[model samples]
Target: MNQEFKKYQAQTSPHPLGLEISHAKGSYIYDIENNAHLDFVAGVSATPLGHNHPKVIEAIKTQLNKYMHVMVYGEYVQKPAVELAKLLAENLPEPLEQTYLTNSGTEAIEGALKLAKRATGRSEIISAKNAYHGNTMGSMSVMGYEERKQAFRPLLPNVKFITFNNFEDLTNITTKTAAVILETIQGGAGFIFPQKNYLEAVRKRCNEVDALLILDEIQPGFGRTGKLFGFQHYNCIPDILVTGKALGGGMPIGAFTASKALMVLLQENPKLGHITTFGGHPVIAASALATLKEITETNLIYKTLEKEKLFRKLLVHPLIQEIRGKGLMLALIMENADITNQLILRCKDQCLILFWLLFEPKAVRITPPLTITVQEIEQGCQLILSVLNQIKS
Candidate 1:
């Protein structure tokens, strides 16, 4: 299976941590060899409720028996999709009432960008440097990292980059700007949180310039940040919000939400601004609806901060320079890239799962499933500390 994966599958990296999985439950993934690997990355923050969560799986099964994809979105008014959208609107702030669902986060981002341009009648879009939204053309164009995007030149035109949290850079957003998109919490840039009302200031500046503010909550949404969305921690409300990753529980989905008036632009003038055949498939929407219900009905979101505190208390070592971010979306910044790499590799061998940040090589990602228990947290932290001690000594 490993050889076949290497031979047939197109990979993103030359070296992939190819774990041949047999099954997964809750916070653990089992390999074909029957070794149970305790999951800490939660499928890179996609499996919010954990692998094959019973509630999400049951919802998918129930929907499968009734129907799957009846028709393209907005034509059929599927119950799951409607309920999910209505729930989202209820949870989100004002002006973010309607939703456009897509297959993935990048696609949702593409739709959001188009909506911004359509509503504002402007072409120039601004994003932060060291930000990771998604991998599609429009999202790639806004990506701050040049090394990864250099080969794919001539991306969407007029897209600009700004330093996140830099007050001076706020001057660049002007009347001509269509939208200013930013990750609520900078993910690939080592889980950097907004500094001192920076997001609120940006909201004010965009309002002054009459430009739309798009917040990409792809990695930090759905109770990952102790709140339903990371932007909730700060007081900044975006005009268009792009969401995915954990939105569908364990299923693949993404969505962009804006006011009904703004989203209607996608259906007017040009007509059919963006369309996906499988955007809001009924089964996926059912899974997402169950996931959202679980998050809201229970105290899972509130416990993320308590879990975060426990992790901080346990993961103290000299090799670790800092632990950045809030709630479950965290990164452990080691002194050097080599040390970080060694810790991650060693932990994998020890039957504990650990991962890395995209742009920051010296940082280790620790976005575990929100359902992880205190015992699991202690076990994972002990394994990590053991590896760090070996590297140091």
Candidate 2:
């Protein structure tokens, strides 16, 4: 199977953590040999309620039995899609009522950028340095890391970048800028958080210039950050809010929300300015609706901060320089890139899954599912400490 994967499938990284899966349930993934590899990454923060939660599965099955995709998005009145958007509006702040769904987060980013340019009549977009939005052309154009994006050059023009959490950079977001796209909490750049009211200040600056603020809550949204959205914690709301990953439970979906007025502009001036056939697929929307209901209704969202505290308490070690991020969205900053690599690879061998952050070579990702138990937290931390001890010895 491994040989077949390498031969047939197009590879992203040269070395892939090829774990042959039998099935996954709750916090553990069993291999073909039935070795239960504890999942720490939660499919890179996509599965918030853990793998195969009953509610999400039931919703998907119910929707599948009733109907699948009958028509392209916006043409038909899909019950699941409509309900999901309505529920999302109920939870989000004002002026962020209407939603446009897409196939993936990157696609959503593309749509948001286009909407910003169209609404403001400006072509310039600004992003944060070391940020990872997505791999599509528009998202990649706003990506701050030039080394990763330079190969895919001739990207969308009039894109600029500023340092994340830097107040000085807010000045760059002037009237010429259409939108300032930023992660609610920086995900790939070691889960960096907004500092000293930086997000608030950015909101003020964008307001003064009449530029839209697009917050990419792709990784930190959907209850991972002890809030339905990470921007809630910072006391700042974006003009356009983009979400994906955990929004669909274990399924795939993405969406961007703005005022009904702003979103309607996409319809008339360009006549289907941004359209997607499978944007609001019934089955996927059902899954997302279930996921959102579970997170918002239960105490799972509130428990994330408690779980984060437990992780910090158990993960103290000499090699772990610091733990960055809030709630379950976290990164362990190691002393060096070599140590980070060693820790991740060694933990994988020991049947405890850990991963790395993009563009942050010295950081180890620890974004486990929000539904992870106290016992699971202890078990994973013990395994992490054991591996760190081995590395030290």
Candidate 3:
């Protein structure tokens, strides 16, 4: 192990696919040994436009020459952040006109939860079983998996879990419920989608109970699902929508959107319900703005479905049981977690990087960049199938 990696870098797992990276461009990353590896993971689905996209990089340079962090919270009125918010307002659904930027997806979730409670004056929060919002304490409180969070017990109180695609459990979102937080696509849970009309029904139930609905679009936002936001695919709008991941192109950023009427609740009752030191740093916002521009202004958003079709068409193997999810946000279900593990490791060795979901061990994630070429898809799939043929059950 490298000295810095051994001493300073904390490992998320005892065994990591520790490949030292040199630089990346397009859909390829070069290691220190100059071995060019074809990227299929796209930095855990955060580089939807692929690595070092010229437009995104240019935006960062422009912003760097102008400004960086000006002040804390929403005090400075930075143009990149403000214009980015306005652009989101223009593209988003009705009443989702205002946005509060954050440093990461989990912070956006935290802000949404706080806003929901402040707006509804309710104490209970309802989330889905097998769902992942983030690793923060407030997010961990709602995580369905207990093994990873048991040691960090006594998180947020009054947090409840309901089945994701089951309308019957919607009764859990009662009048006392402050909010119902959910992933538009259950990312960590094998990219599991809500059954047809399930989201609409959930929206109706939330309205019936006067509980705010906070949809976590961290994974599937910014044209990952061939739509600006995954919630758009469901035809149901959330009271508060949290977005991140690819929102900053390759930069770390997050933002939650809501109606101005509802968002104002954060101002008066407590005056600054959520505050962060680097909430809307200008450079990050600039990259995000450029990413949004590329997705919306070009054909990148529409290309996702075509890329997804190519993936589905090529990823054929007897070991693969099912492919779940829409657009490019996808997963391949194997017979067991062991098989999934073997496949991921073998693919990495073969230069076709693959990863797994936090909650879905039997599934391997395949969320590539929207900019991934069709040839690249076929190439990666060929390598994947070859590995599957060579691997034993």
Residue 9, model 3: Cα distance from true site in angstroms = 1.6
TM-score of 1: 0.99
Encode model 3's per-residue lDDT on 130-245: one tens digit a residue.
Answer: 88999999999989888878999989999999998897898788988999999988999889887879999999999999998899999989888888888887779999999999
The CA lDDT of each predicted structure is 0.94, 0.94, 0.90
Give the winner by lDDT: 1
lDDT of 1 by residue, 194-218 (tens): 9999999999999999999999999
State the lDDT of candidate 2 residue by residue for 133-213, as single tens digits: 999998999998999998889999898999988888888999999999999888888888998999999999999999999
TM-score of each: 0.99, 0.99, 0.98
In terms of TM-score, how similar is model 2 to the real structure? 0.99
Per-residue lDDT for 128 in model 1?
95
TM-score of 3: 0.98
